[model samples]
Target: MRERYEFEGKRFLVLGLAKSGYAAADLLHSLGADVVVNDSSPETGSKEVTALREKGITVICGGHPENILDKGFDTIVKNPGIPYHNPVLKQAVQKGIPIWTEVELSYLISEAPIIAITGSNGKTTTTTLLYHILNIGGKQPLIAGNIGTVACTVAQNAKPDEVIVMEVSSFQLAGTESFRPKIAVWTNLYDAHLDYHGTSEEYALAKAKVTDNQTEEDFFIYNADQHEMLPYIERSAAMKIPFSLQGKKAEGISADDEMIYWQGEPFVKRSIIKLLGQHNLENILAATASAILMDCDKETIENVLSSFTGVRHRMQFVKELKGRTFYNDSKATNTLATKSALSSFQSPVVLIAGGLDRGHSFEELRPYMGRVKAVLALGETAERLVDFAATCGVPLAVKVRSMEEAVQEAYGVSVEGDQILLSPACASWDQYPNFEERGDAFIEAVIKL
Candidate 1:
């Protein structure tokens, strides 16, 4: 077991007693710290609270006392879901209380090196790939962060010998203060979560914070091709390990068809990469580059990548329905990701798009109208997308009420070798509970067809 630090009678309060919070509470208690666990929803976090309380941890569910912070807790570790605008966090700031997210807390207790990854889309896939590559290369890696397990929880359970591979999201990035990783891999960035952050600039800044805390000793890994990240790349204090799929080969790595190569080092990786699209290849390049930076040998990196397949809800090839391949890419929740998915195929695509509008411009997607045979729009953003595609001179553009109607129509129109892709370029909250639900529905409907 990992050694819990001796808090020396310091008071530690854990807000949002979810899985991460329970782990935080236990670790704090083991260190002889006075720990208080608070969860606003007992029903949501009920079982977790009971388990923690069974271990002698103080857990208060249902509501947080207004004067709780007045007790002078030395630190408050907040769950990532709690926004920056939360009253608890606001009060903590006002009272000058040291508040940390689980990620921030992980950075404190972590002895092993951390490889942190963040981006608008491919971070989850990249993180999982890197974890596999590192382990195959003889480095034990603990996979955690936004993809599954929480960071501090992983840290408390982690053996000191492993490398921590974290799939960090922009929301998690926003709440962290000093969560510095040894290797910060920024896959890419784009306008997302404008609803919470209020602006694209704020969202970018929050995503950039994954590297904001890095020191001169740390290394910053970035995609040089992303124009969004290029303008802000110079701001990083860490030594840059840049990777690019386009342009000149840099100090890090680059990949052409035959090889995944560094500046001068060449490795003809046996890559029968199953994942489609240039974006996925870029994801592979980024993950492979990260592996090399972490001291993974070229052979191990290549081997792990060759054997690996894509993740669920991203771009899983569902099945062939009426001669058309149905691809469930319900994870493409924004225009950039959807654009990548759409551009992946040279075939005539019947694109099932539209979802909640995040105030992004659909003007750039007009160029893709020719490649897409028909645009079957659905979700709340359907009408707006239909209007935009019409302006682009697409005669086959049509709007439908739901995913089922859209899928059936798309299947009807698609010929042999054509593809039906569910890559919604907008948020999923408009119709479904989330993107996963939307993607699942797409798969279910297509399978029946």
Candidate 2:
């Protein structure tokens, strides 16, 4: 296990008691700091709270108490999901106690250098691909952050020789103060998480924070196609390396339909890559730029490109049943992502879309409707999408109640050489906890067929 950072006699208040919060609280307690963990949930018997209590750490449950300030906390390690308007956080700010995310603690403790990646989409695929390339190139890489594992927990157990490759989210980045990575990547930006972030400008600002702490020696890899990010990129101290799919560039990475160009030279042929879609091409280019900048050889990069199938639930190939292929792009939780998925295919697709309605319209997706042979929409936006499909002049539009029903509907209309795609343009919160669960359900239903 990696050694804990210094915190002897320091008083820390940990808010939210979720995975990241518990990990931070536990770390602080282990380092001889006076730690108090608070959760709005009353279930003190929950595994995490119980474990902390077993460690002789203080636990406050049911509600956030006002007396937390009386405890004289030197720092407040907050769960990234918790809003700034939360009473405990507001009080902490009023009292002048510095609030930080668990990532900050992790960065302070980790001896390993980091490669942090963030964007509205494609973060997981890019991060996983980079991990594969780094491993093949002999870099001992550890994956963490929004992909699943808690960043601090990974950091606390990480060895100095390992390279921590984290898929960071805007939520995590918003809480960071000094969490600098040796290499920072912004895949691309789009208007997303507006419900949580309040505005697109705020969301973009949070993503930009990934490179805020970088120095002249660090590298910033980002999408040149997203001119919206240029202002923030210009302000960064790190050397900027941009990736694009539109045209060949003099510096950084870019790709056409045939070859991926790195610094204006042919890096890899598109025929060698196993993953599909224009979005996946962008992801590959981003990963390629990062790996090349990190000194990974061409042979290793090519091997990974040829072999790596893809991350689960994002353009994952399910099966070819009765001569029709199926793809699960459940991670396409926004209109832009769904459009990217749709634009990737030249042939007509029986598109299965819809999920929790996030107040965004289906109007932006109209242009891509020509490629969709039929529409099997489900979840909260089913009927609305069906109505929108009617306006798009889609040949067939059916509103289904469940994923199984949608899959069956798509199968019924599909013919030989056609594609059935599960590229929901909304979140999975209405039907499942996350997109993976929803995607798993779709895969399971397909297997049953």
Candidate 3:
């Protein structure tokens, strides 16, 4: 078992009963901390809540208490998804109570070195690929964080010889203070999560925090092509390593369309790569760099690259119905990601898009609209996207009320050799809880057809 950090008498307020919060609350309570777990839901009799109560930990549900700020907490471990606009969090800020994400708490207790991957996109794909490569290379590897598993939950069980590969998000990175990775892979940056961070600069700053506490002993693998990330790269104390599809030279890692070079030698041939698209190429390059840095052999890296299918809901193929191919890219909740998905194929696409409006225009996606045969828009921004699609020279644009309607409309217009893509250039919040749920619905609908 990993050694526990001292929390014997510290008071902690876990401000959500999500996976991270539940794990953190449990860990802190086990270490003899005065833990208070709170959630807005009225699941007072829930298993986790009841267990915490049995251990003498406080469980507050039904609603957030008005006096939560006065509870005298030494620190507030918030679930990353919770916004700063929450009344309790705002009050805690006013009271000067320290706020932390479970990532920070995990760092305090983890004995294993961490390879943390963060960016506006490709974090999950790169993290999973690195984990696979490391495992194949004979390194004891465990994957967690942001891909459904909580950080602290994995930390408690981590062995010293293990490598914890984590998919970190901007939300999770923003709340971390002293959480540093031994190897940090920042895939690429883009304008995303503006609703939470409020600005592109703030969003980038949050991602840069993954390397904030890293030292010279650490490695920072980043996109050499992301000129905007140069400022953050200059600020990092870690040894800088660059990965690029443009063939920028790094001592151990560099790549072109043909092959990836390690120490000036061809490591992995690009011809065998299973995942298509330039964005996925970037992900593979970053993952290959991190794997090599961890001493993974060329064979392992090449094997994983050749066999790795792709991450779910991100350009995932559904089924071919009546000579039309359907792709579920519901994870493309932003214009940049959706654009990447659109660029993957040469065939004209019957595009199903739109969702919760994040106050951003779809103007940037206009260029990719040339490849779209028709647009079946849905969600809060459905009507607005139709106008944008029309302006982009798309002849057919329909505003539908739901995903099923969008799919049905797209199928009517699609023909042999035309692809149907559900790459919403907006979030799923207006219709579904998350991209996964939205993607599942699209898959189910396609299967029925």
Candidate 4:
């Protein structure tokens, strides 16, 4: 790990004690910074807190003390999920104290060039795919950020010869200042996390930060199909590499129904790709473009694309039991994502959906319900989704109380050639802690069947 002397003697405040917060605090403390970690959760006796305290860092828990900011800290390394509207953070802004997410720290200490991926959806899939391609192509890539591992933790031990592939979120990007990636990929943009960002424009701006500090020497691979991303593309200093599913463009990556082309040259046959959905094609194009920029050969990219079934919980093919294939798309926590998942299959689909109702209408989903043979709804939005499914002329709509019940109901409605997909068009918080847990439950239930 490269030694960073800049943090030495600095007084740093880490807000919120999640994975990112812990990693940032530990790294900062190790670099000679006087770190004070604060978590709104009341669990002061937690092992994470105890460990930080053991490292000579102050641990504040239970709540945000109003006077904590009065301590005159030089900078604040915030957990991405912690809103800027938090009382402590609002005060920090008023005081002109600079704040950063752990990713900024990752960039500061890392000897390797970073490849950051961000989007409203498909960040994980693209990050994972690019990492796979790079790894197979002998690029020695280290995966981190929102894909699971903390970015700072990965960067801590990253070597100069290696590359860091990070799946960054808007929450993380919003807190970054100089966290430029050598190659950045914006999979696609959509209305998401408005509660955290407060506005769509703000959310887009946050995602744009992936390329904010990138130079002409760097590469920005983005969705040319998303017109909303054009403004940000124009503002970026990086060399633009556009990927489109529409058709073969003048340059960059483009795909037809049969082939994926690189700068108008046929790179790979689309029929060989195991990943489902046209949305995934966009992800493929973005990742392929990134791998090319990383010097990965066409053969390596094709090999990875052909073998990668899908990212787990994101339109992942679970199994084909008695010829009724099941897919777990628990990551489809919004209408746009669910629509994409629904469009992936040609066979009749027994879709198990519904979760936390954020007051968004299911009307946006109506147009895509044609192939849906049956609907097994669950969680807070169950009845609402069933009612909506009825309006869409879906033959069978059942309200299921649990994931197991939903899976069983889906199987009951599905035939041998049909697909049973768990692509909840709402957040999992109403029934489970997060999407992963909800997806795991669905998978376990599927295995039982």
Candidate 5:
């Protein structure tokens, strides 16, 4: 209801007419900023675009005209899907226009505290889990960001006492200015989204911004297990909190002998998380650490973990037919994450993989190939993967196209005690809308069989 920016009278260019961009345009206008919103869509009949014109914000739907980015504007803010390296974004950067993401803009205006979570993987599970624990502990936390919700909308409408639990992505992180979370959590980092961020280091730099502007009073919770993040962690002067899943000597929170602990603070009750897989255990540790640091009641933390159902696409069980289990791990968009999903199963697996090739190495997928019954490759990357897995002793590999064929072939080749895992260690844009669609298709195919 309130305007955060005084830009109500200044010129602003809003790019990417998606949810965040539209919200950003409206928020700027509420502050008296003159804004023009653009979407690449070639049609002007969209309901949200129509609403923007009605609200008195300038709406230029049907495609982004190049002249728009060239014109003088006070600042530029982008939606999460708009790559930081886009030509328009690059031009804006060259013009020295102050660029910002929706998260950054929201942070600038919010009166409430924030706990922003960012990572190549694990952000959604960690963000949602943290929110669940906070609610159980009696805190009002609004969940938003790359986890399929507009945080700017939530932050704009929430009361001052309520906090924001944000799942920020690398795209959102790149253009951030003066955005800092009270408790910033970086779960882990791997080489992902090279198509957008260009290099793994650049991508990590964007993600590290979760703690970028943090002060010593703010908490920077990171994975002690990811050595790549250690350079940033060591240099961070913020109140450092680290979590681990293996060995002792880890500081902030850890799990030992089927028990979870936060900073040596024993939980009031012994808790056994119901989620399957060791990767889920890692998510459990991160959530427990952040909630405890937020001063959530020990009992609330324990209770929430018990009730926390895992995220939809990450290792979601479809069915057990003919004595073989089917798991939809469409969220495993990288080798490391897929490896984690595969490592959870002790039985032999007919692992269905391959998708939009992201320059990922199958070397990491090698160690776990022994447990995989055979490799079922799909999409553009299939042929190259067959050879890679064979190096790890998987002599039998089947190449198929589409999730249906992969599932059918897997079922034909697998028998009792073997698992059918759709854990493709690659992006889904080649054949699906997102990981969700890919995972959904995998489930649908399994149900048909």
Candidate 6:
């Protein structure tokens, strides 16, 4: 839509055909580039694959061919989930072919200035919040990236007057080269995706790429509480803005128990904010800072914050039956997130947790388990989490086989005024495809009850 001619006539390889891959291949082909799409998944006859082939783009499926790179492509638009250690990607590296995620493509073609949010957690909440704030403030904003909608697909129709609020993941950032956002936010850093990155440092660096191509004209809003992020902040050429839960002294955007401050000035009172958890306060501060930079009015920000409960699968309230409230937080795929969810409630909790093991100890959750009345664990890490719950001295700890079982058991253990929460501190990959499906299962089970 922005009349990008750089991709024209260039030979491109679009790897791993999911949503991002399909969008990338389609965009590249439309731009008059010679595009070949490859996917390891055996969805060869799928609608997307069929469509691409009909458009005269080569669509290869089932597995990566050893000689696939023989065609001498100018660039590879790779799907984020595919690791660099992948044989075809490793070969691309050896041959010095440029590899990019679809975000890079999105950045190149979009007429709209992008506001990107990335971190180990809170990306979805922060992205959604900022989008809401900007929308309510009369700014035309589009939501895209890792939050679900393909960014390139959004970019194709993005108007120059619009703004793109993107949720970027470490995997997507890792494959980026020239993908700079006009406003970049690093919510907070934690050890995550170690298997994909091989080390915490690599993961952090990948997250840092949101600011990599930025210049002094851009804005980098980061978590001041994360000392590990300081070095990266100092190195960025973008104008630095910080947000913290640690009061007004943070000097950018800070929050106390009473109020949210903007550069040491009172902006909004804490009581008016509706989102749950201290971690969400961090998200609020970050989103508020970005909105202020975008010239969104304080009243608009306050209105959005006061009413925005949360994004789905992330501390979303379901239903209250017989005075026992249910919340679906299947997005809490790590201990830190679960800790935040646990801290949000004062009532005794019947927590339904556990999923893919990921070989990490749930010991980090022990200190926050004081309010957990019972633990209904499920999936690959069910037994281990229940054992850990026992060690935490939780009164009722049981391993359940499925979400339905977990929901039933949680209700059985809960009493009047108790909170039944589905905040799995592990990934849903063991039993569900993703956190969303896991959350949907929990919600359906709760509805059934």
Best by lDDT: 6
Residue by residue across 173-279, what tens digits does model 3's lDDT show?
Answer: 98988998999989998877677888899999999998999999999999888899999989999998888776736465777868888757777778998887889
lDDT of 6 by residue, 1-449 (tens): 78888889999999999899999999999999999999998974599988998999999999999999999999999999999999999999999999999999999899999999999899999999999999999899999999999999999999999999999999999988889899999999999988899998899899999999999999999999989888778889999998988777647899888998988998899999889999999999999999999999988998998899999999999999999999999999999999999999998999999999888888888888999999998988989998899889999898888899989988987899999999999999999999999999999999999
RMSD of each: 2.7, 1.4, 1.9, 0.9, 2.4, 1.2
Candidate 3 CA-lDDT value: 0.88
> What are the TM-scores, per candidate, against the unseen true structure?
0.90, 0.97, 0.94, 0.99, 0.92, 0.98
Model 1 regions lying over 4 Å from their true place: 1-8, 42-45, 199-201, 213-217, 227-232, 256-259, 269-271
Instruction: Enumerate residue pairs that collide in model 4.
Output: none
Query: Which 10 successive residues of model 2 have the least lDDT summed?
Result: 1-10
lDDT of 1 by residue, 157-212 (tens): 66767889988887777767878888998988776677777888888888888888
Residue pairs with clashing backbones, model 2: none
lDDT of 5: 0.82
Where model 5 places Cα greater than 4 Å from the true spot, the runs are 1-5, 265-271
Candidate 2 structure quality by residue, lDDT tens digits, 127-239? 99999999999988999999999998999888888889999999889888898999999999988877778899899999999999999999999999988889989989999
Candidate 3 residue spans exceeding 4 A from truth: 248-252
Clashing pairs in 5: 7-32, 7-33, 8-31, 8-32, 8-33, 9-32
Q: Report the number of the highest-TM-score candidate.
A: 4
lDDT of 1 at 397: 84
Extract clashing residue pairs from model 6: none
Candidate rank order under TM-score: 4, 6, 2, 3, 5, 1
Stretches off by above 4 angstroms in model 6 are none
Q: Which ten residues in a row have the lowest lDDT in candidate 5?
A: 263-272
Q: lDDT of all the models against the reference?
A: 0.81, 0.90, 0.88, 0.92, 0.82, 0.93
